[model samples]
Target: MSDPLDKATSKAPATLGEGCLSRYDPDDLSSEDGTEFPGAAELWEQLQDTSDSPEEQASAAAQGRH
Candidate 1:
């Protein structure tokens, strides 16, 4: 795997603050905690439509963007 901090990466570093931290919490989606998981359908609907290339599409799909 490529190290994200390596200069060769075309990726950006984490820029999100506390508000965006909710997306990473394992308990955030548990029904017992009074929240719902954003299932595949909800996830697909919420993704941005920016890339049309096959590679980009595959990457997005792998990341649950579709």
Candidate 2:
């Protein structure tokens, strides 16, 4: 309790899976984990709407190759 460095230390939540698939377990998360993202779906939809389709992007790239 007297060590100032110990007060600055933090720990991460438990994870599941391994390697690229590893992620924090949802069941172990709480409000303190900062997992809430109310705007995530809206942001995803906005991004999807603004981005070009794969076919359009491929065609644009093909034109530059000529």
Top candidate by TM-score: 2
In lDDT terms, how accurate is model 1? Answer: 0.58
Write the residue-wise lDDT of candidate 2 on 1-66 in tens digits: 497867776668899999999999999999998999999999997886559687876876798831
Residue 64, model 2: lDDT of: 85
Question: Could you tell me which 10 consecutive residues in candidate 2 have the lowest summed lDDT?
Answer: 57-66
Backbone Cα, N, C clashes tallied per candidate:
0, 0
Model 2, 62: alpha-carbon shift in Å? Answer: 22
Supply candidate 1's per-residue lDDT for 48: 45
* Off by more than 4 A, model 1: 1-51
Off by over 4 Å in 2: 1-8, 53-66
Instruction: Report the C-alpha displacement of residue 59, candidate 1, in angstroms.
Output: 0.1
* Reference-based TM-score of each model: 0.24, 0.62
